[model samples]
Structures are given as C-alpha cells and as structure tokens.
Target: QLIVVFVSILIAFVAYTSQIFVLWNSLGGAVAHTFFVLAPFNVFIIFIYINYALTCTTDPGTVPPNWMPDQNTHFEVKRSTHTARFCKTCNNFKPPRAHHCSTCNRCVLKMDHHCPWINSCVGFENYGHFLRFLVYVEIGSIYLFALLSNRLAQIVEELHTSQIRPSATEATFLSINMIMAALVIICVGILGGYHVYCVTTNTTTIEGWEKGKTLTMKRMGKIQNVKYPYDYGVMNNLRSVLGPQPLFWLWPRTMSGTGLYFPIN
Candidate 1:
C-alpha cells in the first residue's frame, strides 16, 4: 500500500513535469502565457497533495471502547429485529452507519470504504478530504488533457505549414502523457461523479449497496419497505458532508458531528 501511494505521487509529479516540458520546449509557449496557464494548474496540484495527505493520515472516527447505546434512543436495528446494532467481532455496540472494516480490524463510524491506495478507511472524519482530493484530481486531469491537446495541435500545424517535425523524444513523451491523461479523465470521472452522487444523496458506498439489497427484498415481498434516514434533500445532504458553508466546501475540514448520531429525513 505504501508502494502504491509512493508510485501514485511519483506519477503525478512526472505528469506535471511532462506538461512543463511540453509547454516550454515542445510548444515554445511565451513566458507570460506559460505562467498564466501554470498558475491555476500549480494551485490545483498543491490542493491535490494537501487533501491526499490529509485523507491518508486522518483517523476515521472509531466506536469508543465499552460503549453502549441508551435504551430509549432510536437506533438502526439488526436486520428485521429491534435490537441495537452490534459488532460481534469487536464486541461493542455499533453506531448508526458504522461498520467493521476487516482491513483495519476495527469498527469505523460511517465508513464508506477501505481504500487500499491510501491504506486507510474513509469514514466520517476523513471523507471531506477524500472528496476534495477526488475533485482536485478530476480538475487536474481535464486541465492536463486540454494543455496536451493544444500542444499536439500546434505540433501538427507546424508540421503542415513549415514541414517542421518534433524530435523523436518530444513526440514520444507527448504521446505517452496524452494516453495517461485520457485514462485519468475516464477513471476519475466515473469515480468522482459516483461520490458526488453519494454526497448529494447522503449515502455512503456501503449504504448504497444496502439500499439496493433492500429494494430487491421489497420486490420479492420479503421486506415491507426500505428507507434511508439520512437524506435531507440535495443541498442539506451536501452540507452534511462538505460543511455548512458553500464557500468553504472545497476547504480541508470535516463537518461537525460525532458520527454516532445523524438527523433523519
């Protein structure tokens, strides 16, 4: 997992370096134009790294040891039973939306998933950082694609107009970088878009799966109904995950919550 993280960072650095090389050497872009283009790109890069580090290092909230729920408190029950949810493996009462992560060998609060790339469970505490990292990666991928496309077009134009061709090394580097950028766009587009939907709907990836299961059971008449209690409409749902202020939605900060309780729809 550490190797994967290191390799991912190295690839990002190489991609950034490749873009600079194409801008200065291959495209021969003007200094002013290059700086203007690189400014926002550099910012996005920094944001990506910052969020990635936070996501990797932050501790997703855990169930306090020897904790138990109040008898009168309404809690998510075990399947069709009214019993409070419990983790047999951890021998503790599981909070709402909490789940035991086999990878981490502990119960996590509102755990979405255990990401191998970061080697951490993304849960209530770190979800904001994870989402921000995805957003930055998506933006960076698109920017890289556009920059590479422009450089390629210029090379083509120069070839046709003056019969001037790029060196073999430059052409090879451009081709490789373009392919990588395209893959990043496709993969991250799907992943980031899915997470965006999850946030807007106030559903984690695990809960999404459980929702599907309940729907299927309802169709078979095995369950009377299915309900997700956390969805508070689109805007409120976004605020639940990204914080209440729209302006700071992109900032690295967790929403206010203990993760043991959540308001219902």
Candidate 2:
C-alpha cells in the first residue's frame, strides 16, 4: 500500500512537472509543438488506465474465436482439458495474451511485458493506454525532431566556421533526450506495427502466434457487427482503433440459437 501510494504520487508529479511541459511553455507559444508533444502522450496514458481498470481480462473463462487447434494432438491441448497455471496474485486463470511478471508476481491480462517506466502491468485492459502512449511517444519524437532540426539550422547559420560549444547541463540533457527519442521511436514503431498487423488479421499477439500457426483473417467487409468495412479507410480504421464503446467485458456478442445474449452488460 505504501509503495503503491508512493509510486502513484511520483507519477503524478512527473506528469505534472516534467520537462516536456516546461519546454512547451518556453517554446514561444508554439501551440502546435506543445500539442504535438503532449496530445498523444496524454491519450496513451489515459488509455492505459482504462485498459487496466476496465478491459484487461485476468480470468480465462471463455475461449475467444481466435483460438485455434493444431493438427498435432500431442502439442495441441484441448480447450476442455486445458487449464492455465493459476496465478495466486491475480487469483485467476491468465487469459490469452496474459503473462505473469516475476517482479510483480502477478498475471497480467493481454500482457505486453512489464514496463518499469509506467510502473504498471501492460495488459489487454490497458492496451488502449499502451497504444495511446505509443501515439504520444511518436508525436513527442516528431516534436523533438522538429525542434532540434530548427535549432540546428540556426546554429549552422550562425557558426559557419566554428563548432557550437554546449554547457555541461545542455550537453547532458541533449544526450539523454537523443537517446530517449531513439528509444521511443523503436519501441513505439514496433508496437504500433504489431498492433496494426494484429488488427488487420483480426487477432491479438498471443492468439496469433501462440496457436501453432498464424491465422489470416479474411477481409470481412465489417468488423464483426460494425457497419463499415474493416479496411484501413479513414472512417473504418480510425473507428476501429478509437472504436465504438467497447463491450463492458471487452468481447462482442453474437446471435445465438435463441437470440442475442450479451455476457457482459
């Protein structure tokens, strides 16, 4: 409890007092740059919270349609016979895309890997947060790139004959920022690409790769019950990402023999 409170307070402080905000204020009222840096990050963090609290499935009660059986019976575990290793911390069967962090000793649903930076589990519930975070990260990188590029141009213009001498603080800050920018690019780029690929194929990372063979989704005109085609056309794709209110349980319903029944309210 103490640790949790301390960490939460720390995050609150950083989010409110970070250098990014300082830079935003110092950038001569460049609203575009400020938004470019903050919007994506803000959305991402918000999404994470949503996922963690609302949508991430810690229990494995139902097998989603994406789970496939393999030809090799030896390797293929029957769903009826299968039981996930119970996680004491989570107190539930870790669902697909779920992983238990050694450090936390808890199973996270739709696990993306433990992120120390966020000091939280990245799972299905919080997947939205992760994506939003990535979007922000990408935006932040672009902002930095633009800011640096403009500054570099000015320095070149002024120092045609000599190298610019940076103060110790400036040098350290620049180095750290550059490294952070590179890391963000790589991390966000890979995660975004993976998510995109999964969305197009109508699968999650755990369901797609863990089922022994990759499942290819037919380009169905609409996403499940969504009215529009699942193609990357702006209307269709954006809605899918920033989609309709997700099912309360994060899974959609299907018309059954009797009628439509929604497991989650």
Predicted model with the maximum TM-score: 1
The per-model lDDT (C-alpha) reads 0.86, 0.46
Q: Give the TM-scores of the predictions, in the order they appear.
A: 0.94, 0.49
lDDT of 1 by residue, 1-265 (tens): 6765794676576566666557666544666767787778778888988998889888988999988886666578886587889889999999889999998999999999999878889999999999999999889878877888988999899989999887776787778888887888899899999999999999999999999998999999988976788999999999988989999999998658799888777
lDDT by residue (1-265, candidate 2, tens digit) is: 4554563454344344434433444444567876766665555445434443332332212223233323332222235567444445655544434556776666544455555555565544445444554555465565554554454465566567676554555445555555655666687788777876655543445555543231222244322332221235434443444455444222322212211111110
Q: Give the Cα error of residue 165 in candidate 2, in Å.
A: 4.4
The lDDT, on a scale of 0 to 1, for candidate 2 is 0.46
Model 1: which ten-residue window has the lowest total lDDT? 20-29
